[model samples]
Target chain A: MNASSLPRWIDIGLLPVLNLIAALTVAGVIIAIIGENPFVAMGVMIKGAFVYDGALGYTLFYTTNFIFTGLAVAVAFHAMLFNIGGEGQAMIGGLGVGLVVLFLDSVLPPLLVVILAVPAAAAFGAVWGVIPGWLQARRGSHIVITTIMFNFIASSIMVWLLAGMLMAPGQMSPETRSFADGINLPLVYEVLQMAGFSVSRSPLNLSFVIALLACFGVWYLIWRTKLGYIIRATGHSERATIYAGHDPAKIIMLVMAISGALAGMMSLNEILGVQQRVILNFTSGYGFTGIAVALMGRNHPIGIVLASLLFGALYQGGAELDFEFQTITREMVLMIQGLIILFSGALAYLFMPAVVRIYSSLRKPTGSG
Target chain B: MADLWLQFVLTIDATLRVATPLILCAMAGLFSERSGIIDISLEGKMLMSAFAAASMAALTGSPLLGLAGGILVSVALSLIHGFACVTHKGNQVISGLAINILASGLTVTLGIALFAQGGQTPFLNKSERFTDIVLPFAEQAEHVPVLGTIYKEIISGHNLLVWVALFSVIVTGYVVFRTTFGLRLRAVGEKPEAVDSAGGSVSGLRFQAVIIAGVLCGIAGTYLSTAHGAGFIREMAAGKGYIALAALIFGKWRPVPALLACLMFGFMEALAARLQGVEIPVIGNISTDLILVLPYFLTVILLAGFIGKASPPRSIGVPYIKER
Candidate 1:
């Protein structure tokens, strides 16, 4: 039984679900080893992430960041480029947002400042992304190595800028001054209250809407556009893409640019909507987590959405675990996440051989009958 | 002139200390990449080793035991990576990334579980660490100028692991360039099928290379915790592993050149650390961030062919599937 012989639904959906189960089962064992009931932990996590009023909003807030980063990674995956520099690109994007807001906040209206900030962020991210793309295309430098290097360079750049030029005047921390109230993006709770829904206040903001739109945009671009066709072709085989009269280098650059832009947009959620100020290490590990999300999602936009939600639940629930349990700390949450990544990614097909055999056996009788 | 000499000596001393881990990591990367297994998990392996070494040193008050524990953990990780990628034919990069993520999380989790100092091990005493060894008659040597000063300043005082790290480079060079194992390892990386056809086991060679990487990275991690610092801190390896990867590439996967690259990075780092509060003629108090970014920028430049071309192993990152 071959991978291709598996039904599309099983290939796309069932396997991922099974992998999720495997990951969770492993996580359950770890929790058990920590002297905690896995079932109680799971229940607490699920309730904390979704069931409670304000918890949903917090979950969505995290989901928004993942959506952008996952999409970024997914787009790059289409071109066979591993943009591990999403963390760096997003950091630089936040810098762009910081520069734009710092200079334009007092000068322009809040609406116009936000309108300008989006493109500024995306453009900075695209530049950062394209450098490695250009290096790969022109110099034959491996994209993975260059991008990883860029992450460190980006960190140093952020630290330098935040501490020197962008620091709040007279402040010591590596963060910028807060934006004016008028310049701050409205929260989702505030917007919902305006609509009379009485939602709990959380950090969820307008960026969630942008994240959704970006997802749809990515789906349309990747599935419906000629450029995406070329990108996918290049990913399939550069020689085949070249035979088809497409420039693989151009496709690589374009794919990387779009991917970087998507990664950059994550700062809209972190900086403009939530913090209202640029800070050091604001991207946290969202950029790297995107790799796991993309892998689990199989690099499909719809799958990415589901994967993002799942991770968002984990993030929120993990926080709850830290707060509620004495034994299960935040690091334990990371351990669980790492286990999930390992199973879903490195061991993605660990169960596939068995599943394929089962499917073949089921179909054999059906066909004969 | 004396002040200049003192400054140079201090920079060289700092560079040696800083470059120790990088040298080990680059050699580790060289072994892995040469054998066609892209080991991005160098960081993870080092981190896990650092944590294990620190914890063991703290527990037993024996740096040697800590070093052994570190090596054991890293070898286990290396075997896991080999099992996944070499045996199951998993994605090499993904396996590496998964190891990294696992190490990042497990180290912290285990730290909290054991000592509960928010993911930090207790500091080791001087006796429990690989203390710096001073040369005999160093005070007498300091009385002499030039060569004696050089001996006193640059060569006399360094931890045993620093000497071990330096010696490992020569050993790595000889093993990689002069031995039958080196030839087979290189052959497996570039053309595994040819090696396999010639009665060499590709998986076996690759697994051995990975084990070598594990041992080297383990020593690097132990050096970080036991010799370079008092104990383990969260993410102490930081991006040094990645930097080592970059150095490996910049050196074109060669041991000597990679060691040079590591030294260059170490110098840049030493400069960055030393430049604090210092005013230059035109730059006038250069930002540490810019200085910090210099090594990566240099790596990028070197990788982009401004310095030299970096040709990776032909079959690197490709899983070797036995065609039966």
Candidate 2:
């Protein structure tokens, strides 16, 4: 019945599992409160997401973006930094690719341009991210505030640039020129057909692989490398790390730059892989949704993948909710996501009693059981 | 000399109008942040208020009633933020963003359902709207030479909300630094543990701050919908609430400096709006949306550079957990 009688995995994993339950319970209640049958609505949501032919691609399309953003968020989380500017960074990165896709195509081959554009977008996004990181490192400014401000700046610049400079000529709408064909990421036309399950769509592309690679790379960078050790240590105790001969400021900047680059990659993947060009609303809220994914995944790579898939399903399913049940607004899905984050964060603590009881009953099979 | 004077005068007028909403938001932020709430949802709260104000004004044909309704709704939302962050001790950032998303969808859906105008309220004519008001002496003083010109250019005419915004700043200054409630609010923010230890309720202070923020946001929202523009458009609050938050932080969380920060931001916004329609030689033509980006861009750069080492309220964004 004491500490020595506990199962180790139960102790560590119980919190995350309980958080999932709590989130689901809350989301279910919310669905009910909104006058939808929680069971039917949820079932419909799943079917719309996975049952349809092209649905998986649609789900993966959003998941691709969420995973990259979630990774970016997770990278910063490991370093104990908050990069609220991810949205801004992603946006500017989108702009970079949009520009290259639209303007530089005349000079470069499409495949080459696509290859180069992703990195270019990441670079621009990283630059956007680094300013706040630099401020936080050098001047002791709060990244939360500075990055938050930077998001506004980045979005504003996007609006201005898209509405003014990059706007397609002779178009009355306030949008940029249609991306030239060369820079677009390719569909899984061959791969999907061979798999016997792939249905081609407008936004289907190869960025899903790139996103998985990014997740793997982030995991390796944070867990495998010497730099990762220093970053993690500094995040835990900057003063102690400084005492042990590390520059805390340098670590913060590096963490932020890497995070920004990852966020930039998310934007690039979405624009290149899915949208095929940047639009004003190109992201479909992937940047913000990543925050939820990161938290729900507990900032782990595998966890991020799982959480991103769930979020991607919700996003894809939300559209179908409109077609099936006109009353179930897209807002309902967002509400569920928010509830999931809220309850999940708190559920870790809530599950401790049940976990302790289970641990005790297993070790001592007599009265305690 | 005359041309320069003209430019300066024009700039000042633009500064005042743009700054008016910002000042209210900054003051609103001042109360909440001063009491330890990192309010990221100011944008959403203001958005809701603006939506409410515009729609109400259109339906009622009464600006005064619209203003009241706006304040009431925003304050309620602010209370929701307070309850979640301060009482339930939930993650403030998440809760704030939740409120934003909630507001965004709610407003858009309601806009479509009620008005049938695709997230915009029907435009109200001058009689039905909150029109600009010219000060009495200022109007008469137009007969005087340079003084009349200066007064006319600088401060003669503006929406009545502009005056209310300026007055609200003074009120906030007096209430924040000079009053018992204000002291409690600051104490809660800077050192919640201390306040809680000293028999002061941290929750109470937080609730007060949120309500104050909500009221200010409500007024600011009304200004956006009724006073400044003829109708309410979706997401019209745009990024101004965040801009005001930046101004508050840049001003080092002090009332006076916060007002100054708001003014500077307002000037940038106004200038951008003016320049949006203005022709440029080198670029030939520039869209107003690009110009709209100027204030936000400037805020980011300035926050990073000039706002040297600004520290937030010590207990900000962290829910207060009583020591076990």
Candidate 3:
């Protein structure tokens, strides 16, 4: 069989693993050059990411943010659009959450505040996501360029609002005051205790469950629904989509709005669940990392979930590496992440020939038997 | 009236300095895009070259050597990009973004390892940097009106690199518009199949264009480290590479128009610098953050065709696959 006709298992599962191994090998070489044993560093990373107490919680906490952003990108990718504005979307979404909490935290019940905050965050992010989408659909602007520009605009707007309009009274830092406790999401550890299991107290909250639900929701939307069929059809070919009597422009706007809404959900995790306050730069490159997540996961919900978890491990484990080794700093971790992005994205088909060769050879023997 | 004139002169001077890297980078992008490659790796090349230049200037105390080092590093990155996009048929934008991410991480890692200053090199001595070259008779000519002020304030005291940037515009214009290679380059971007049928190698032309981009980006990076600033800092290129790309689009991917766009952006930057903390009527204290966002905001607006259509090359982002 040819490379393109490879089995789905190898295509989705084995190839990404091979690429991940290649990426890690290069990272290992760099680690060796930096005077650290790559094996030891790998062991430390794995342990820090999963085996240590409270590590899994933090990993999942970060995973929650990636899930939102990754799904956002995945949805947009299905419509042949690159939504690089997730960083900005998440920021504005946080603003939405913060606004809702700040206004109703003292007056409304906890459940009621959450009920209002979720939709508010999605609406704000959708607004941010749609402008670039609209420009691309109606005015012929490139989505990538416009989204990138909006990221900067979103950041500058946030800085101004945080430092000037939203600064807590009597505070010098550029962050709003924490909302009342009623608005805060319950921690996972508390829920686990309620279920009679002891667990480490960590920042993992209700948002993690919501993120899992979103994964299921996205899976259903993409494969089991007509809208997803139209989105995927548009991604395959705009001409065919137009021939099908669907307005490509409307589909683009719809896809981008959905992507933006998913990105906005990140604020519920980052702001209401953990920080309990809106702050500057809290998105912290999660939006960009989402692009990598979508790429590695092959722009599928299941793959995105797995890729998000892997990246979450890298993030938490990379931080552990920084804390443990002088030679392995945060930048080294970023180098590894970048290498993974390079391998998975630009060199996506680089190893396909080799994989196809091996698979064909294996199949020849099995078929004869 | 004279005070306002002096302010204008000074702003124009600052605009040139700020616009130097931007103009160089936009021209670099023009070469790559004009030859059918979407070069978003401009930022990566500039950052890596800036690191090389600063490190060399700091180590050896020769700004010229530093300049050479920067160019070499940038050229290497350009070759890598060509290998991925031209030879391997990879996605151009993904490759460019990967180069940027790789450059960002590698530079900081190397800087921390080499200098031990948390990703910053030691400060360069004034003797090791590209110092200003005051024009002949500039001091004496300052007595004359308008032209004298322009000569003295804007053109007389810029470093050698600034003059080189200005000269590059005419040179790039000639190379892209007048030369046979220029014809082949434009042909390759628009219709690679036609160029290939006409006995030209599409990949070869594209690779050459990428190399030119690398060299120009190197010069831009060198100027940033060795002339505009004292030494290398993490992310010293800032967002100038993307801004350069925006300027390229704003200028509709041409050399002369791109240069004009860069100057306009540079003027906006200089204006922002001057206007910080200065209050204006009706708006009441126009914040620096808003000004900082102006270039990107304008790019989006311009991109939306509020000004006019800014079309890219026909087959710019597509990888040219040869049939056997």
Candidate 4:
């Protein structure tokens, strides 16, 4: 039986769930190897992610970053491009956000500064991303290798600027001065309070709203727009796209720019909403995590949102697990993440033959009955 | 003038020391990529091997045991890469990325669990690590003039692993270009169907290439932990794997050119280390941070055809699906 002949639920929902279970099972074995009870750990993680006070807010805060980055990866995936430089793009985007707030917060209104910073961040990230895209399209450079190189270059650039010029006065750490007063996005707790609904304080902010908007925007752009058609066409077959008289190179560069812009928006959540300063390594492997989220989400906006929430829970819960267990640390989340990527992204179809076999056999018996 | 010459010599010496791992890794990448397997997980494998090497050395007080342990761990990872890319026919890049992430997380997690020192293994003493081996007549040559100074300062007193790195390049050059297996490996990368027609198992040959890569990366990782440094710290690979990948591209994926590229990057790093806080006549103080970006920046430029073209294996990154 053809694998694609499976039911929609099996293809889109059941398969991913099964893969997630496979990843979790492997993670459980690892936890056991480290002298911890996997079931107890899972319970603690669940409680920490949802049951604890203010945990949902923390999870949502993390979910916002993943949404931005997952969308970034998904957009590139539609164009058959892998923009792995999201970490660098986000860092540069934070720099743009920092520069704007630092220069304009006192001179201009806070809202105006933020309005300008969004495009500025996108533009900076686009420049970082489009260079590699252009190289891939025109110069025939491999996007993966160039993007990886660009990541290193971005890190070095960040270290240089932060340590030398951006370093706050009288501070030894490599970070910029905090943004001007009132420059922050509204925290979710405060927003809830304003609406007469009390909630515990967490880092969740108005950026979460922007992340949702971006998702809606991406869904519309990818599924409904003519440009999205061209991008998907280019991904399907560049030769066919060329036969249709569209310039695939231009499409590649444009899609990468958009992808980079989405990645760049992550800074709004981290820098403008939470940290309020451009700090060293603030992206903190979130860009890479975006790859897993995008893969597990199957590059759909709705799937990405759900996947982001799952990862957000894992991240929040993993922190709690670290505090509860002597052997397990926050790195345990990273291990689980790797396992998820392995099972979902790389070995996604490892169990497909068995699944198809079982599905066909069960369906045949039911149909005969 | 004498002092400046000594400084130059010392910088070259530093270049040799720093370039050893890059040389080894470039060779490893050469084997993997030439055989049509994209091995971006080179960093992950080396990092994991470094942790394993450090842990074993700390436990057993033997550098040899550490080297074996490192190689064993690295080969196991290479097998996983093989299973994903070859057996499952998965996205080669994603599989490599997954392994890299897995290694990065697993190393730190296991390190914390085993040693409880905040993701660091116990430091090794001289007996547990590969110390510098002084060449014969080093003291006698040091007393001689310019020629003697060059011999003693530039050539003598490197760890055993450094020589192994150099030797590995020669072996790689011979094995890649001269042997029948090398010819089959190259053929599989470029045209797997042709090799298939010739009754050669493409996957089998590719697996051998990845295993060779694994061994070289293992040696590189062991060199890092037991020879270059005392123990494993978190992320001890520190982008060296990526740099070596760049060097491989910069060298156009050949053994000798890749070694030279590694040396060039090593020289830049050595110069950066020496030039920190040193003011020049016009440029003033050149930031080491910018200098560190040179190799990556150069690779991008090279890839962009600003200098030369870097043509990879034709069938690279494409999974071979046997035609029905």
Per-candidate local distance difference test: 0.89, 0.78, 0.90, 0.92
Q: What is the TM-score of each candidate against the true structure?
A: 0.97, 0.86, 0.97, 0.98
The collision pairs in model 1 are none
Clashing pairs in 2: A160-B290
lDDT of 3 at A92: 90
Question: By the TM-score metric, which is better: model 1 or model 4?
Answer: 4
Q: How far is candidate 4 from the true structure (C-alpha RMSD, Å)?
A: 1.3
Fnat of candidate 2: 0.28
Candidate 2 at B276: error in angstroms? Answer: 2.4
What residue runs in model 3 are displaced by over 4 Å at the alpha carbon? A361-369, B281-283
- Give the DockQ of candidate 3: 0.74
Cα lDDT of model 4 by residue, B139-245, tens digit: 99987988888889888999999999999999999999999998999999999999999999999999999999999999999999999999999999999999999
Scored by DockQ, the top model is: 4
lDDT of 3 by residue, B257-305 (tens): 8999999999989988998888777887878888778889888988899
List ranges where model 1 is wrong by over 4 Å.
A367-369
Docking class of 1: medium
lDDT of 1 by residue, A224-300 (tens): 98877888889999998899998899888888888888888889999988898999999998998888889999998
Decide which is better by lDDT, 1 or 3: 3
**Residue B140's C-alpha lDDT in candidate 2?**
79
How would you encode candidate 1's per-residue C-alpha lDDT over B61-138 as one tens digit per residue?
Answer: 999999999999999999988988888788788788888888888888788777888889998999999998889888
Colliding residue pairs in candidate 4? none
Ranking by TM-score: 4, 1, 3, 2
DockQ of each: 0.66, 0.29, 0.74, 0.82
